[model samples]
Target: MSRRGWVLFLAMSVIWGIPYLLIKVAVDEVSPETLVFLRCLIGAALLLPWTIARGQLRPVLRHWKALLLFTVLEMAGPWFLIAYAEQTLSSSLTGLLVAGVPFVAALAALLLGEEERLTPVRLLGMAIGVVGIGVLLGLDVDGAQLLPLLAIGLVLVGYATGPLVVTRALPDVPGTAASSIALFVTAVVYTPFALPQLDGTGQVSAPAWWSLAALGVLCTAIGLALFFALIREVGPQRALVITFVNPAVAVLLGVWLLGEPFTLGIALGLPLVLVGCVLATRRSPARTEPSELADVDSAVP
Candidate 1:
């Protein structure tokens, strides 16, 4: 990677990582639906014009079915669940849990007929990742955290499913257009629910508002652009390293800024899940990494 690639890499690390903290803040005063809606609205407003100016916005509409599926799985469902989970789970924990996305994606790929074999190493990785989940669940098994953990599981599934939707359905859609359209549609879908929640917006604090702005502009819109740019600069394999780095930044920001608890379970489970994800998603020595990794935008909250 060049100096510029390093800059984009680090910048995107912070950009994607901060959303966990921001969502934690925003969801305190705003409902999850409203928070997602507002963020998407702002993100669409920011990105759609640029997409249209580039004449890439129209192709996004041609694959409306897939775009809708992508919106539901990627932007709408995961964002809402993450917001809801952050209501109970620490921002740090939420980030750690989400780090399992690549593992989930690997399983999804196999299940969806991608021709990767479930080798011994990959199976062991999957087992380790599952054990990590067990460790996370064991920590709060008797507590009210089970439902939130389930919610995180759903978010992971949704995140995992999103890339396949893009690869199979919207392969030719421009990244900006796909992001902008998906967000716009999600915003529209949540508008009725979100509108009522806006009644209490006056009571929301500046931190929350700023957090929402950052979530929309920095996390959703610019994050997509930089993610694509990172792939273009350093190739998709290296760009995928952002997924590994994001959780650490998220955990750090949560502990340092939000004062979130870093429990024993998270300490033990985080590395297990991360290492598992690396193994499960890694290409074999004889295999080439997929070029479609560049085609699909898998930026997370």
Candidate 2:
């Protein structure tokens, strides 16, 4: 990676990672629907102009259906799920749980007839990831928390599947434009549920407001730009390595700023899941498939 790539890479590492903590704070005050809606509204407001200026929306409209699917899978569904899960789950645990996305993404690609062969090492990686999941769940989750964990399960499926949809179905769409359109569509879809609650949002705390602002501007709008820049600078494979790095940042921020614990489950399980991600996704993707990697990269808390 070049110096520019390193700069973008480092920016996105914290940019993407801190959202889990942000969601944890903001969701404590607002409904998940409202947070998702307001965050998308802010991000779309910032990014839509760029997409239009670049004439990216014309090609995006040609594949609106796929774009809508990407929106739902990547933003509308999973973002809300992550916010909802964070209400009960610790930020560190939530980030750690999501580290399993690569495992699911690998399976998604194979089932979708992607060209990359699933070697034995990848299978072993998945097995190790599953064990890590067991350790995390066995130590941290209680029966009462099962529903939130299940929400995280849906989030995993959405985050994993969204990329495949964008890759195969929206091949011509630029990453920034696709993401901007998705955010716009998500904001529109959630308007009814989110709008009615805006009257009460004035009561939300200062930190929550700051968290929401950072989420909208830094994590969603500018974050996409930085990610596309990273991909352009360093190529998608090196860009993808940031996923392995994000959960650590999330865990550290949660533990330090929010005073969330570095539980034994996280200490043990996070390494296993991240290693699994590395091993599972080590095989080179078909060159074409990863070009819009922001599809996977952008779908986070």
Candidate with the greatest lDDT versus the true structure: 2
In lDDT terms, how accurate is model 1? 0.82
Tens-digit per-residue lDDT, 28-137, candidate 2: 99999999999999999999999999888788889988888988888899999999999999998999898888888888878888637888898888888888888999
* Prediction 1 TM-score vs. true: 0.94
Clashing pairs for predicted structure model 2, backbone only: none
The per-model lDDT (C-alpha) reads 0.82, 0.86
Tell me each candidate's TM-score.
0.94, 0.96
Clashing pairs in 1: none
RMSD to the true structure for each prediction, in A, is 1.8, 1.7
- Predict model 2's lDDT versus the native: 0.86
Instruction: Please write out the lDDT profile of model 1 over residues 124-225, one tens digit for every residue.
Output: 888898888679778734478878888999998998888888778776666667888888999999999999878889999999999999999899889888
